[model samples]
Structures are given as C-alpha cells and as structure tokens.
Target: MYYSTDYSSPIGEILIVSDGEAIVGLWFYAQKYFMAGIDDTVPDDDLPIFKKVKKFLDDYFNGLNPRIDFRLEPKGSEFRKKVWKILMEIPYGETLTYGEIASKISSKMSAQAVGGAVGHNPISILIPCHRVVGTNGKLTGYAAGLDKKKELLKIEKILS
Candidate 1:
C-alpha cells in the first residue's frame, strides 16, 4: 500500500506518496505524469517519510538548502534511474543543460533521451529536475509547468 499526503507549496498543492518506508513519488497537483506509476494510494499524513519530506520542503521554501538524505524509492527504468541520480547531483541554485547531463552519464546517450528521462521523473522538487535548462540557457520542458519551474529557480536565486 502506498501512503500519501498533501503539501501546500508556493508552487501549488503537491501530493507526496510513499511505500510505507521510503518516498515513491511527489507530484505537483495536475502536473504532467502526475501519479504516473502509483497505484492503491491511501492518504496518511502521519507517515514518517511524509513528515521528513514536509520538513525538507519547509526548509527549501525558507531559502535554506536542505540535503536530500531521506530514503526514496522512485519507480522508473534503469536509464531513467541513472538520469534521476544525475539530477540529484545538481547543486542547489545551479542549473545544467540536458546535453551536459547526457555527456556525464553516457557519451552514447542523446540530449533528447536525457530530456525524456528528466521529464518522467516521479519525484519533482526532491529530485531537482527543475534545475535543468535548455542548451541555450532557456527554461524549458518542466513537467510541472514552465512557470513553476521559473518560480522554483527564482526561489533558489538561480533566476531573477
């Protein structure tokens, strides 16, 4: 069973999901691929992982960079998992282009492929997929909407 809870963030209402022990998903309400791989969810705000995530988000919104040390179990393919791992390495308040991530992960992988994996990330803010930009430094392809992406970047002081 997947335990879940709701977080009212500056961006919007976010639904956080967990598989009892570790977080499995965190999706911006109605965002693209919302609840993509989840099933049999039960709302439980008191879950331990939910509480940790809430604190992490609170610190993030308060302009403090919180470490992502909590357990996470995002469901995805091996390639997507590799991409998400790279996403986690993106420093707070910094951005990387899809091409850059592709090169870091595998020379054979295309930027377009990396973009697809980034877009499909199950956990949104926690994975920091918003820290990715286009090759020309243009904000693009955020599953949670470009406006929210820009807002997150601005909150992190990456954008003015």
Candidate 2:
C-alpha cells in the first residue's frame, strides 16, 4: 500500500508517496505522468517521509541545498532508473543535454530514448530532471510543464 501526503511548493501542489518508509513517487498535481507508477494509495499527511520531503521542499524554496537524507524508491524500468541516477549527478547550477545523457549511457543510445526517460521522471526536483535540456542548451519539454522547469532552473541559478 502507498502512504501519501500533499505539499504546497513554490511551483505547485505536489503529492508525495511512500511505502511508509521510502519515498516512491512525487509529482506536481495533474502533471503529465503524475503517479505513473503508483496506486492503492491513501493520504497520511503526518507520515515521516512526508515530513522530511516537506522540509526538503521548504529548504529548496528557501534556496538551501538540503541533503537528501530520506530514502527514495522511485519505480521505473532499469534504463529509466539509470538515466535518473545520472540526472542526480548534474551539479546544482549546471545542465546536461539529452545527448549528453545518452552518451553517458551508451554511444549507441539515442537522445530521443534518453528524452523519454527524462520526461517520465517521477520524482521531479529531487531527481533533478529539470537539469536536463536539449542540445545547444535549449529548453525542452518537462513532465511538470516547461514553466516549472524554468522556474526551478532559475532557483538553481542556471537561468536568470
């Protein structure tokens, strides 16, 4: 069963889901692919994981680089999980093109395929999917809307 809670963030209302321990999903309300891998959920605003995620969002909006102390268990294909892990390595104020991510995975990997994985990222800001861009540093689609992605980059000082 999934334990869930809601958090009001600067970008939007986010639903944070956990298995009572590890965070399994977090998405902006009504975002594309929101809760893509989750079901059988019930709200529990006081779940410890929810409290930690709330604090993380609080510190993030307050411009603090809060450490990810709580556990995360985002569900996805192995390829997608690998892509998300590389996204986590992107520095706070930097960006990586989808092609770059593809190269990291395999020179044989296509940017479009990487884009697919990037676009399906369920954890959003915590997984740093906003840091992924198009070639030549152009803005591209984001599951939570490009506007939210831009706002997040602005907060990261990657965009001004």
Candidate 3:
C-alpha cells in the first residue's frame, strides 16, 4: 500500500506517494493529473518509512541537503536497475547524457534504449532521472515535464 501527501513547493504543488519506507512517487500536480487513471492509494500510517521520507522531503524543499538514507525498492527489471544505479552515481550539480550512461553501463546497448529506461523510472527526483540530458546538452523527456526539469536543475545549481 501507499500513503500520499501534498506539499506546496516553489515550482508547484507536489503529490508525494510512499509505501511507509521509500517514496514511490513525487510528482508535480499537472503531470500527475495528466495521468489520471493510476491509483493513488496511501498505505498504513504506522510505517516508519513514511515519516522518514516526509522529513527528507521537508528538508529538500527547505533547501537543505538532507541525507536520504532510506532503501529504495523501486519495481523494475535488471537493466532498469542498472540504469537507475548509474543515475544515482551522477553527482548533484552535474548532468550526463544517455549515451554516456549507456556506454558506461554497457557499450552494447543504444543510447536511445537507456533514455527509454530512464523515461520509465518510477522514482523521479530521488532516482535523479532528471539529471540525464541529451548528448548535445539539451534537456529531454522528464516524466515531470521539461520545464519542471529545468526548474529543478536551476534549483540544484546545475543549470547555470
């Protein structure tokens, strides 16, 4: 089960969904409402993970570098996990091209494939999928939208 909370942010209102321990989703309202068919069920309230995740989000929105020490058990295939792991390694205030990540993970796969996997990433900001950009340095398909992506990059000081 998942529990959700709404937070007002500089960019927009965000809906945070968690499974008591790990945040399952943190989506901007516009993007979230656009995909209306998906379920938004909240899990039980007694889980410690929910409180930890909520605190992390609070610190994050307050411009504090809060350490997110929770385990992220995102649902995905092995290849997707590999791509997500590479994304996590992308330090804050930095960006990487899909081709770069693909080459780093396995030169055999195409960069486009890596981009597709990234696009489908369930955990957004926490997974840092927005950190991935075009090889030419242009922002690409961010699930939360490109404008939000640009805003997040600017907030993180990676877009200056």
Q: Which pairs clash in model 1?
A: none
Question: TM-score of the candidate numbered 3?
Answer: 0.84
lDDT values, one for every candidate: 0.92, 0.91, 0.76
* Each candidate structure's count of clashing pairs: 0, 0, 7
Rank all candidate structures by their lDDT, best first, as comma-separated numbers. Answer: 1, 2, 3
Candidate 2 or 1, higher lDDT: 1
Residue 142 error, candidate 1, Å: 0.5
lDDT of 3 by residue, 51-138 (tens): 6766876776666667778878666789988999899898877899999999998769899999888987776677888889996888
RMSD, model 2, all Cα superposed? 0.8
Per-candidate TM-score against the hidden true structure: 0.97, 0.97, 0.84
lDDT at 104, model 3: 94
Give the residue spans of candidate 3 off by over 4 A: 32-40, 43-47
Model 3 residue 93 CA deviation (Å) reads 0.6
Query: Which number leads on lDDT?
Result: 1
